[model samples]
Target: MKIYIITERARTITLEVADSTEIMHIKLQIMINEGTPIELQKIVFNEEELEENRTLKSYNIVNESTLYLFRLERQVGEADMTDERKVFETFENL
Candidate 1:
């Protein structure tokens, strides 16, 4: 079956997976393709959070089902620097 995945960045991709595929497996694929860590991935289907231990079939996910993917936001530490490139670009345009 093919599942539609929409990333938090609004990117869309289709994945071919089996009904027996676990939710964690899907996260693994996303990690490989989108560079998102599995621990940070949150997948929602039918307005419900999909469990990592459950399979697609357990969620009654069928072919052509769409799943939303979100990356868990992490708290920025004091050592983290904000990207100032956008501000620089705006000044350049001015």
Candidate 2:
């Protein structure tokens, strides 16, 4: 089960090795990559927020799932998001 991870803050990307479950693996991977512990981090997926205290295994995640990491891009504003979102939305509308 290859689980994907998105480092929202650092904009770093990596794959988290599957564990008996994705519990500790999630914590360890994020901690190692970002050098921050779960207790002091904010994790989100696909524009939805996630709790760090809980385990990922319980989230009903499946194999080969594509996860996204989002963060505030410095010197950028909501305009950037709206523009990109509009493009994607427009494409789908077409």
Candidate 3:
């Protein structure tokens, strides 16, 4: 079956996958195709978060189903000064 995936950034892609494919596999494919880390991916279907242990068929997802992708929020305490500086520097270059 084919599924439509929409990223938080509004990027869209259609992919063909088996109904038996696990949510984790889809997450991995997103990471590979969109460069979003699998650990940071949160997929929503029918307004419910898809479970890693569950298959698309289990969620009743079928052809042409649209899944929303969101990035997991980073914890405040997990922020690093170096990462912030890098982000600023990259924007400055732009």
Candidate 4:
């Protein structure tokens, strides 16, 4: 089945999976493709968190199911870095 994954940054991505596939495997794929660490990834569907040991079938996940991906760690080079750069530039301009 094909599932839609929405990242913490609100980026949407598509993933092809099978009913027998485990949640951990999906996280592995996200780690490989999106560079998100498996330990930091939290996948949620229909307001419920998906367990790593469970299969897609266990969650009744069907084709086109939307999963929300959340990263527990702070993402580098994102808002934090940008804000720091802005502060540095402001100080430089003083």
Candidate 5:
């Protein structure tokens, strides 16, 4: 099935995935496509946050379903500063 991922920055990404695909896998795809960290990705459907361990089927997500992606902001010490900068740069480019 195809799903639409809409970022908070108003960017859109279309992806093909299986019904059994876990939310974590979707986050990974976003990571690969947008350079966003999987840990920082939050997927929401029907105004509810999707659990990483759950499958799309568990949420009854169908073809052409739209999911919102949000980047979580946190202070992860000095080691995470570069990653945070990258995420911001990605959105800035869009």
Candidate 6:
């Protein structure tokens, strides 16, 4: 079955899993990109939040079912143009 992994990290919903892998690591890594505090306890897919002890096998999830790492945080602030320019300039000089 075809399943989708809709991630909520930085709006980066990726479909990277094609086999048995620890999705928790991927979820955590993507969330870090947001550069903010994250509470894994509240992570969920659709309306059914995942539990700390729940593994992929718990749901009999196979190649058919899709997994998503959804982050439940609203992004704040906008990109400071000045900061971006400065960073770009620094990289250009190196």
RMSD to truth, every model: 4.8, 11.8, 3.8, 4.9, 6.5, 8.3
The runs of at least 3 residues in candidate 6 whose Cα sits more than 4 Å from the true structure, single-residue gaps closed, are 1-3, 8-23, 32-46, 74-94
Which clashing pairs does model 1 show? none
The TM-score, computed over Cα atoms with residue i paired to residue i, of candidate 2 is 0.46
Best by TM-score: 5
Residue 26 alpha-carbon offset, candidate 4, angstroms: 0.4
Off by over 4 Å in 2: 19-24, 46-48, 52-54, 68-94
- The TM-score measured for candidate 1 stands at 0.78
lDDT of 2: 0.58
* Backbone Cα, N, C clashes tallied per candidate: 0, 0, 0, 0, 0, 0
lDDT of 1 at 72: 88
lDDT of 3 by residue, 5-75 (tens): 99888989788999999999999999889977777889999899999999999999999999999999767
The most accurate candidate by lDDT is 5
TM-score to true structure, per model? 0.78, 0.46, 0.80, 0.75, 0.81, 0.39
lDDT of 2 by residue, 32-83 (tens): 7766555544556556566555555556566765555434343445345757
- What's the C-alpha lDDT at position 36 in model 1? 81
Looking at model 1, which ten-residue stretch has the lowest summed lDDT? Answer: 74-83
Evaluated against the true structure, the overall lDDT of model 3 is: 0.91
Give the alpha carbon lDDT tens digit for every residue of 1-94 in model 1: 9999999789997999999999999999999999887878899998999999999999999999999998887545412233356656789999
Ranking by lDDT: 5, 3, 4, 1, 2, 6
Writing each residue's lDDT as its tens digit, candidate 6 over 1-94 gives 3345545443443444434444464355445654433453244544576664555455555665645554454444443677679879999999
Determine which window of 10 residues in candidate 2 has minimal summed lDDT.
69-78
Note the Cα lDDT for every prediction shown.
0.89, 0.58, 0.91, 0.90, 0.93, 0.51
Error of 4 at 19 (Å): 1.0
Full candidate order by TM-score, most accurate first: 5, 3, 1, 4, 2, 6
